[model samples]
Target chain A: MRITCPICGERDRREFYYVGDAVALERPDADAPPEAWHGYIHLRDNPCGVTRDLWYHEQGCAAWLVVTRNTATHEVLGVALASDEKGEAR
Target chain B: MVELAPKSPLAGLVPVTVGRMTLTEVDLGRLTSVAPYRGRDEGLSEALKAAHGIAAPEPGRVTGRVAARASGRDEACAIWFGQRMFLLAGADPDPALAQYAALSDQSDGWACARIQGRGATQVLARLTPIDLRPAAFRRGHTARTELQHMAASITRLGEDDYLILVFRALAGTLVQDVRQAMQGVAARGGG
Candidate 1:
């Protein structure tokens, strides 16, 4: 798979590391119940359709990216800087 | 006090001239890394310019003075490494930048090498994923990318000249890899 880094442009997927869902960026409340915190940290949706995920461009621009992709087809729907998510919708 | 000559990271291996390509070790003096505080990029740039007389380059760009003589002590090449981060080489960077940016002394942390000649681009293309095509990676373009799985910063100084910087610890490996790659390119007649 090819991921387009917002800073370095398109590059081979081998250069990046898959960091799981983008939701990981949102942390659970510190005052939440243990079970709620556990679910936030340990449990994740293994959806087969389009989903937003996080990728670390470890070998490129070193930017964290939010990649919208289809899990079933392995096709990338869109990509944006994780920092830019609040400013733009894919 | 007894003194010893400085040995390059690729000591005894570089200054290699094979066919139309040469991989030479260059000592880029006083390397410094500057990363602005959050939302302070513009401020950092202005400060750098006001103090050093050199403006910070934009992302994926490099700015440096072209000096005819190597003794020009103030010549500094600042290559953008990422968002709000730049790698500054050549002479002492303004220490005042520390107020607005995180400054790190990188003088001994990196090894600088220059690839130049007829087939220099082809040799580099074999090792890095960055596009070496002239039209795309034009002169003065800088990119931080992976070179054979090692993080590297590359700057195009000219059509056939490139400045490559890698971690000092990996300098030996980098030189060996580039030499082997250059041999392959030469064997193929600049393939």
Candidate 2:
């Protein structure tokens, strides 16, 4: 698979280190209940359709990216820098 | 008293030639990694231009020269290394640059090599996954990618000349990998 890095353009998948689930970014507050922390740390939906995940361009630009892809078709729908996504989330 | 002499990583290795291609070690002089502070990209570019006569290069590109010899004023160049980072090679960086960016000395951290001549692209093709076609990766284009499982920075300096930089500790491996690729290409009568 090829990932198009915003800064470095397109690169092979081998250049990236996959970090499962973009939802990992939404960390629960330190004072949150045990169930919330447990869900954040161990539980996953593991959906079969469209999924968003994190990927680090370890051997390339070293940028964290959020890749929106379809698990069924393996088609990459979109990609954005994680920093940019956080800024927009705010 | 004992005198300490600076030795290159590839101290005893000589340049290798296969077919029409040659792989030679290069001394990039003082290497400095420049990372502009947040929202200071413009300031850093201006400071670099004023101090070194070159601006921060665009992503995947390089500005200035990569000289064959480290001597002379024309040896300095700014190569875009990764996101928001540039490698200032072949000359000493100006102290004034510090106000706009973080400068870290990397003079001895990397070993550089130049691969040139016909079929140079083929030699690299065997090692890297990036597209090396001249139309896609023109002169001054650079990429931080894997070179046969080793992290490497590759820059195209001329039509058939490329500059490769890898960790200093992997100098021998880099040479060995490139030599084997060179031989493979030559054996196929590609060069």
> For residues B1-191, what per-residue lDDT tens digits would candidate 1 score against the true structure?
99998776767768878788888877777788898899787888888888766778887887765221122445676788876688777857777788889998988888888888888898888888777788889888888888887899888878878888899899888888988988999999983
* TM-score for each predicted model, relative to the true structure: 0.92, 0.95
Model 1 chain A, TM-score vs. native: 0.85
Model 1 Cα shift for residue A60 (angstroms): 1.9
RMSD of each: 2.5, 1.7
Residue clash pairs of candidate 1: none
Model 2 off-target regions past 4 Å? A87-90, B67-74
Q: A27-84, model 2: which lDDT tens digit per residue?
A: 8789999999999889897889899899999999889999999999999888899988
lDDT of 1 at B7: 77
For model 1, the superposed segments whose C-alpha errors exceed 4 Å read: A86-90, B1-4, B66-74
Ten consecutive residues with minimal summed lDDT in candidate 1 chain A? A81-90
* Candidate 2 pairs with clashing backbones: none
Candidate 2 on B35-152: residue-level lDDT in tens? 9999999999998898888889999998887544332455679889988999998778999999889999999999888898998999999999999988989988999999998999
